[model samples]
Target: MSSYISLIEKGIHVSEKNVCDQDKIWSRYSHDKVDIGEELARVIRTLDKGMPLHAELRALSIGSSDEPQFRILETAFRGGLYLLDINDCALGIVQERIKRQRTDHVTTIKCDFNRIFLDPQKARDFFRDRLGKRWVHLATLHHSLYYCRQCCWLELFKNLYRGFLAPRAAIHAVLMSSKSKDPSTTTWLYNHFAGKFFGAYNDQDLRQLKKDLQRETVFKKAQVLLRTNRVNFYVDDFEKFMAVVWMILLYPQVHRYSLKQREEITQHVYHHFWRKKKPLTQEQDHLVVYKGLGRRGLI
Candidate 1:
């Protein structure tokens, strides 16, 4: 068997054990609310060290944060493994990282206006090639856009599971987020068909003019797809990889949860999962007391 296949089989075989250990390392999945960052980091390191080439890692998340995943990515990248995840973090950071990397080895699938704006012909062609005859429906395109917008990741693999490959393969899978709506984002989606899919530079009149002309073409394309009743928007590929990133970001306590939750989950894993057979004492927790920490957000 290939190294990647071996790693995935191992991950699947041990997944139940990892989840059902005596200590609650996977409390977050059960909605018990615990931070599993350290445990996540430790598992990633072990996998990288052990498998080196093939290790299955998955991420799950809900919310708009990237700092935690950034830390994981930094660690993995520095470790020379470059295997990581980011679920619901800001998409811009993900895009920026890929742009910075700019290599053929990395498979980057995203549905951001910036990418289309930067290169519309390339974007359209990619969808056409990936989706084949299915790229005829507006709904499919919209769903594809959402998947890329929401679910995106970069990785290396010989073959992917059906969930990762199927959606982009034959049909479009629609996924909707219940998160609070943003007017700017919503507006961008509604105007997806406009000739200038991307917003104009800082000039307001120029932006309006661009949208006006593009809306005509957008409507024309939509009408054509509506008549055919067949649409394809490669949502599956985008989201599966996205799930991977989200899982990586969630580990190491980057998203919402109390500090107590973080420590409890960490302690549970280190003690129970690793066969240590003892709780982590307060002294072993290591609370770094750094000063100059200011309020976050509003940035």
Candidate 2:
């Protein structure tokens, strides 16, 4: 298996053991639910003013993980939902949950977003039967766009906007801003080391993405709105935090790192990012909302 796949498997195993405890997991990041809720509410309110109350709206979520976010989107939109994730474990977990909840409107596809955009024709073919003539009205890529390499993000955005979005559709995204508050010493070290293992983006990358979007003809009519919100993390819960971090890092070939180096990295993460005895708070993320009329002849 590829190192990425192996890392994901290990992370899934760790999650099953430690992070799967619903209570513990919820307690650690319950504020995230609140943050997302507020943002979704804003999006809904804005859309409602222009859309009919009973209008059926299709939605898409990239990197939708096994979380309640998809459920919220389905409930609010009352339409078919397309959820994409590269992690099979996450996709299966979410698919099963949706089944149990009787949320038959959701369709989970296990694949990388990059692959989908790499060949737009294939994407259209794969989704055409299921989607028919409908276009997605609401889409989100929350805390997930970073998974794509910085340079490829613009193309991904172009494909998503052109191929999938309906007329006047809104795309909401939350991304870590390099311009945000300075990282903690541990976070700095973690990013430094982690970048060696995976493709990651900094603030400059995000700025470039925005610039590219502005210059793109497809998004010419798009009105981009930006906001920031500080997210709090539980520093007292080291194991839980690491579980989440490992899942994000998902590049588990530790053979590249010497034993001592691994130990040092772990200690740095725990001390700086986890903050040991102190509560950890991340700098506010840049929440960008893109709204515009769809193009004339795309897809």
Candidate 3:
């Protein structure tokens, strides 16, 4: 068996007491009933979609880098993956297991995150000249958590894995929260609730999920995603794609204005749950401290 499969088996079979770290995590968030693993998974996927999968392995190209990219990477290292972006100054030797881990055959595509430009040509050239067809690239986009908040893709990912990973705090919030949760029942109901809320089996009322549940395909797919961090490979599985799509749906605010736009909402709901009510000041013991903005009364 592959090491990745072994890791998945361990994750699938581990007892709650053995895998859960509620006490240590609760102190940080205070009060929440969601699953930590799911939450961490969302945050990791968000970070991965926002930046390179292995930014920690590369040197910081000091420039106008986006915050979400940095934020998610820092979170993932803390959650599991084991590599720290040098940009995360607060992190040191906190994770012992990750220190022994190694990353290979990975390269980040450099570009200005602040700018919006489509380069199908450059992308094609990268594959032609740089990474061959066999090489996989998770192209991340640096978007403002505020401007581009409707993460339907994220909600999709969560809903797909809601059955298995929902026990984790992050998935709990996504599946149970007002926006993502089904309006009715709430009692660790993954299959029923997700089908009702996200229309996983109902898009055309095909009811394909009945067969899918028996196959346990989604669980297998989530295992692959957890180990490899690649979503583009499983195009054949619409259910899996919908899970990632759900994650995208959960984004707080969406800047893209189109006719299909459901409502004029921007900023993710989760952002409000944890967004800073006030700007950074000397009083806050921030790990990434910055000098207060100079006088015009705005710093």
Candidate 4:
């Protein structure tokens, strides 16, 4: 067996007590949430400018997971929250939270909108009866654009702008820069390992999306705002760190890292990241779109 496998067998790095689960627990507990939390707050605050004050607002959260956005949006606006996610676990978590809280205005829908979002009629047909023809005042694709192919991005945003977005609304999207070279960065780490093993990684990101949106006439009247921010994730435990590695790599589900490939990635992250005490730095670009804002929206 390779040294990586031996480490897993011996359970020295992750832990011998509760094993991998404990590592995951520590990782989640230690993740830096403040920066992203503040970013969301800032974005929502801006979107709040045009929101209906006396009446409740309508919003859609794409690829919704149990994250800070759900809580923030639910509190900031007293309207229906449509949760769209393809992953069962993610949707389940948010659904459970809603159920436990006895939340009335939250709706969870499990779907893979990658291809579906490209088709306007399909999107409208799917959401028509479900959404009661109530267009969203705000929509968010939080850290979920990785699944969307570059070719589909234009059509996807076009659909939102022409179909889902209300008369005066905005869509906020956050994605990691795919061009960064900083080793501590999540972008670099993905490029390093995924490129080495698979020879390919995400070539499209928020920057490219920004440019694409700007070139299109559909968004000519819309404000395509872009900004950058940094956040880091780290844990002393190897298991926890590996969990984060897998998370970043989109392992097991999205990306099929072969067992041998997994072993290879395991060794690389363990030595270079875990041993060196390097955080998985994520330098993300934020994109916000507002159509027909006039002077009401932030320029």
1-299 per-residue lDDT for model 2 (tens digits): 48534443443344333334533464356366567767766776666666677788788888866655665787876778888788788888887887798888888877777777757786687558656757888778877776777777777777777888877577777654554334542234335666664434244345557677888887778865566666565534555655655433332532244444455555655555544454444443444545553322111
Point out the worst 10-residue segment of candidate 3 by lDDT: 281-290
lDDT of 3 at 5: 43
> Can you tell me which runs of candidate 3 are displaced by over 4 Å?
1-101, 113-117, 135-299
Q: What is the C-alpha lDDT profile of model 4 across 1-299, one tens digit per residue?
A: 59666665333233223333543453365443455567667766666676556867778888855666678778765678888888787788888888899887888888787756789888788668778888887888876787887778889999988888888888888877887878778788788877877787768777888888999989888888888788777766566666666666656455667666777677767677766777777787778888767655552
Clashing pairs in 4: none
lDDT of 1 at 60: 16
**Tens digit of per-residue lDDT, candidate 3, span 208-257:** 22224335534332221111110111123222222222223331122222
Q: After superposition, how far is residue 80 of candidate 4 from its true place, in Å?
A: 1.3
How many clashing pairs in candidate 1?
13
Please identify model 2 stretches exceeding 4 Å from their true place.
Answer: 1-27, 179-181, 185-189, 192-204, 241-257, 266-276, 287-289, 293-299
Query: lDDT per model, in order?
Result: 0.26, 0.62, 0.25, 0.73
- TM-score of decoy 1: 0.21
- Weakest ten-residue segment in model 4 by summed lDDT: 11-20
Best by lDDT: 4
Per-residue CA lDDT of model 1 for 1-299, tens digit only, reads 48534433333233223211311232212211112244334334433443335433222111212334334534443312221123324445655665686522222233432343234464446445533322210011111222332212111000111112222111111222222133212122222212132232111121222234235432222111000111111112222221222232232222432444333433333233223322211101101110111211010
Better of 3 and 4 by TM-score: 4
Q: Each candidate: how many clashes? A: 13, 1, 40, 0
